[model samples]
Target: MNKRIQILSFLFLGLSQIVFSQIKEEKLILDKKREPEVKKIEKKKTSVETIKNYPPEEKSANPVTYDITNVPAVSDFKTSTIQGQDISPNFNTDYQNNYVRFGMGNFGKILGDAHISTVLESKMEVGADVHYLSTTGLKKEYDWNSNQSNATIGAFLNNYGEKGKLNLEANYGLQDYNYYGIYALQPTSDTDLKQKTNRFTINGNYDFYSNEILNDVRLQTSFLSDHFSANENQGAITVNLSKHRLFAGNDFKMNTDLGVKLETLKTDFALLNQNKSSFFNAALLPEISFYKGESYLKIGANINFLNSRNESLILPQDKKSEIIWSPNVEVLFAPQDEFRFYAGVDGGLKLNSYAELLTENPFLVSDIELRPTNTKYHLYIGLKGDIDENLKYDFSAGYSKINDMQFFQANSIFDDVYTLNRSAYNFANTYSTIYDNGNLSEVKGSLQFFPLQNLDLSAELLFQKYQLDNLDEVFNKPLLQATLGAKYSMLNEKLNFGFKGIFVSDRTTNSFEISPNNISVPTAYVSTENRNKKVGGYADLNLSAEYKINKNFSIFALGNNLLNVNYQTFNGYKVIGAQITGGVKISF
Candidate 1:
């Protein structure tokens, strides 16, 4: 046919130029998506005139800062409010063998407390305590190893005002003691059988109060320092005033106080460089008290004056003056709420002078010893009662009289050497020394019973008497003591058991002679004898137990001389028969 219609008219003219090149590649991908939406609508109309001619750097989102040097500096930082007032240290140690009865002792304890506070106010506190003790053997010629040490430090100040109040206190202390000696003369010699003692102390206090005076009054001041190695270094100063009142009988009330005290003492022993002494004391005391309903009354008096000086040239370097009188009275009687009654009386007077300085550049004097100035009296009575709710009773009695009483008589060519002016007069025993007079008396009683309610029962009694003017040749008899005890608590109270017993009696007198020629010659040509002995009454029993397995744990068991009887209560000292110990404790 016409060449197949001219090849279908060039295949419809190449499909009309391929449909116009597929509509120009779909309008060039719709003009690249409308040319980025027509350049984002011409960049939103040219950013609306540069955001309407610029004005908006106000973009804080909250910020005000100083670089702080690029912030990052913490070299070991620690804080818990500065470690909660920092001060934590404590250690303790204790060991025992054959425990109580003051034997076989070993202990060490340490403690500390510190405080400081402030954010806007003030406060400071400091504290310390340390102690050590030891005893292991020997106790007659000494040698039982004894040691003691003590230390204390304190400081306090507080002020956080509103009205008015102030307090400041300071304290310091040190104590040391050592003793060891056990005869045989030199059993591993500790040269001259060592003995040492030391002590030092300081104290201060100040107090003041004011309600603008009259409606409130209080004032105080105090200072004290004491040091003793053997005998003295003391000082004191005190002053106080107080007043409180409500008088027109609203059950009557009155309280008053007045005081003054000044004291000084310095005895320089400093290793026996030879005796030295000094003293100055001044005192005034006034007190009054009265309270109603349950009754109370008190009165006090003390007047003192003393100026003394002694610097032995072997005794007399006199500068002595003295006047001392003390008086006191107190009474309290409770009419109900479990009965009570008390009574008291005290009296005193003392005057002194003694001069005897031994050896130093041909200096010797002994006869200025007029020390028979005296007055001392004491009488006291007491009673306490409770009868119904679990029984209790107490009774006491005392009587004392000492008038020019001082005794010492020993001089038979130094009765075995050991003298430090035993009331000097040794122109080679100018008719052997003599002085005698004495008195002392006492009585005590107690009884308590719970009977049940965790049971506890107690009984105690003591009586003492000593009166000598030649107690048949020099005293040693008259002291009776008794004690009985019981206690029990079972398991619910976490177990606790106790028992105690004590009873004693003694009587002794001795005088002996039988010498061939140890010459002190003639006691009617020797052969003198007088001896009496009755020392056979002693009993002691003690048992203790405690256990609490909770609340920081606990366990304690002790038995002392529980029947292992074998006695000797001083003559050569020997007592320590039975022993048992158990211990465990934890606390926090």
Candidate 2:
């Protein structure tokens, strides 16, 4: 008819130009995720990866939930606030490997704890623990009515074999004290004026990831003893070995660390004090790293080998060997996602052990001496993120130069000859350990506030400047410090409440001559013993409450130094007032 209607109008304009154009057929996706046995099982080996492996929020800066209905309160268990924010307590309480607690207080204080653990299904785990603390009312005098006791026993082992992980630890401890800060004209009081200690520890570690460059090995050993009333004794032994090297991903990264440490110190007072101090330490750290996006850099060095001795200073220049170098750098800059900036230069070699300085002063002075404290320079800068996620912050600035730098003096101040030609110094009871050549400058700040969602608030501040060499005071060092804390949680999580406050400032000691007749002893004032003595300053308050009563039991109460402010953390020492502890914890 017109050539078959022009071929049906050219097949309807070729199906209307393929239905008006814009493609529309999809279905040919064949990407078995790069098949080939999944790229051969991701190339097998992985363990020496210098940088990568931190999925748990980069390994916990916080944020973990095991969600037991959002368990958070236990007075904010696992505490870490004051703005550092560690707060992790989603408590299923470690599946109750076992637990126990007991308590007593009011000067004759006593507390005890117990534990047990197990986990074997080839993930081998085992544990043990025991702890106790004691106190008997005191107020007669070396420094003011004192009695103390401490104990501990611990054991652990964890293994996750199949060519890797293994860890073990052991511990033992005991302590007892009573010196009574004399000088109402000596004489001696009770329990023959005591002080006793004993400790033991062992540690082991192994981490083999055989492929991809992994390695980690460690071992440690320790022993300690301290006995004194007069006929003093101080002892120590430590051994350490370490090795680490692992590198994996993040563009370029490398790591190597090697270590060895052996220490020994033994001293006996009287007979012109016997001596023995030996140290042989070695360390080498190598590092290089770079990370893209959000930036990060790490470059390192910290090589050292020291051999020091004193079998009583038979002089060979007093026997000491040295070779040290420090500079371990770090950097980080986070473009966004809340913020981050960090900078660092760190140096090491601390090890001033005698059970770590009697566990931070159990009223030292049993002819104690041990050395190996050298920071040799440190500089730091920091700023941490989080403005959302309920607020978080950290700020820091630091500078340090220490060579020995350890101080705690106030002993041998006055006795025979008022302590000698205007030298029998007199500050307070006792505590001795000095090694100064210090320099430190610091500034710190922190804050955290969680509007709600159970509430939490934290605060911290510190400012300091201390310098000493031929000493010009750096004694108890506290140039300003602060803390504020709070925690809350209710019903659902089963109750928890807490509060804390602390502040300190102005500290300088030559044993505080501070006289206005000692300002009625409310932290001391006055000043002058040729300079630097103004202990003063104090404020402290604390409280806590807990309930939990179900899922494994809990009940707690603690109230310490509740503004019964009578400070003196050394220097005629006298603190501990207004205290209460109530406890009950059971999970089996």
Candidate 3:
């Protein structure tokens, strides 16, 4: 019986162990099935919190209450008196955009100028200008009529928008000049000695405000003609592109300029048989600049393609097509606001157009040639700074090597006629260009002093030295030049006075004599025994005063050549003497 009881106990213990194991497995399975729902609740809690609902209304065992009562307050401060201050009314000043001035003086002088500009529909700016100046003639005893007249009319339209700006302009000009200097040496008909020039121009420009590459574009065309059957026509187009980029751990600006120009000149010459010259040039300019707080460095080059059919009195007719390159580099450092330093080396090809030549010296011969000036290199260093709040100064020095520099030489018809009276032309009153390779050095300085709020004084000086490869002198080029000016206003700015003085140093020129037999050939002239001639320089002083009668009217007086020095600028040309003029100005 004991053995039977032991077996039964073992069986009972084994069965209990199996039952507990099954119960534990069932609990684990249930938890696993609910895991995803629990995780979802936890995720919702983390993503968005839910406020608990307030506990259901319940009666409180104890409650509290407070009583309200009114109380009076007393004031112990006294009121103080306030003082009033006087205020002045503000007035707006009306500005003038249109003005007309007319003046007359001795030597039968007449001057008239008019300008008007206004906004159209508050969107576009339109303006027009007209100017006329004339001088009847100099003293009759001077033996020649130095009459000159100039007139010009121009109109411009400007349109500005959020994206860009556009500008268009057209101009017409007329000029009449008398070759009075020629008459001083010989007698000639008024018709033969007079020159008239007509000029017309059209220009268009557009600027893109926010474009990354295309910044500005311009197109220009002009036509110029003279009474002697000399004509020049020019057309040009230019485009400027720039981009700002970051590279090599620094900010840099890349700029590119593309330009194309075409020019033609036609002049009738017996020897050359209606000489026609044409020039075509295209240029590519690229540069990179690095800028840092008031300092910068720029490195670039100008690449040019030049083609020309050129002929001149001295140079035989030749056709040329070539490519040229020039350096463009600059550095600037502004260590301080009051002091700055800069240095640069630059060069380029310059067009010597017929219009430019005629503007410089109106007595040029019809057989003149055209060429581009080659400036191989020009190195310069400069210093500019404000000495003080009221005074400023600048100084600079430069050196350059140039090729094909032009100079003017006077023409003579007869070699044997020591005295000009015997020859038909007496002194061929015409000039022609001569070119040479040369080196030039220059120094310049300027100063400005503002001693008073309404008064200004300024002065400038320049000095130059040239060494030519083949020419004896740099004809008609002044070695030294200076200018001084003073301006003052008083009596509530109603009265204004100004003074200006200009001084130029002496220059050197060459005289040439032609073989009478080959009068038609322009290249037949030879230098005189005295190759170099000295030309005396002169000083010109001018004074002006104006008294404003009211806001829209004013009376003014001008005095020119106050020293009355009869100075000759060219070989035979004498500038006008002293003169005075008084006029009234109207503003609206």
| Colliding pairs, model 1 | 137-144, 143-181, 314-356, 314-357, 314-358, 315-356, 315-357
Could you give candidate 3's per-residue lDDT for residues 70-97 as a string of tens digits?
A: 1111111110000000000100112255
Ranking by TM-score: 3, 2, 1
Which candidate gets the maximum lDDT versus the true structure? 3
For candidate 1, the TM-score is 0.23
TM-score of each model, paired residue for residue: 0.23, 0.28, 0.76
- The 10-residue segment of model 2 with minimum total lDDT is 35-44
**What's the lDDT for residue 117 in model 3?**
73
lDDT values, one for every candidate: 0.42, 0.57, 0.63
Highest TM-score scorer:
3
In model 2, the number of clashes is: 20
lDDT of 1 by residue, 480-558 (tens): 8777776655545566666666777774533233333345542222234444534466666666665667755556655
| Winner of 2 and 3 under lDDT | 3
Best of the two (1, 2) by lDDT: 2
1 versus 3: better lDDT goes to: 3
Q: Tell how far residue 233 is off in model 1, in angstroms.
A: 32
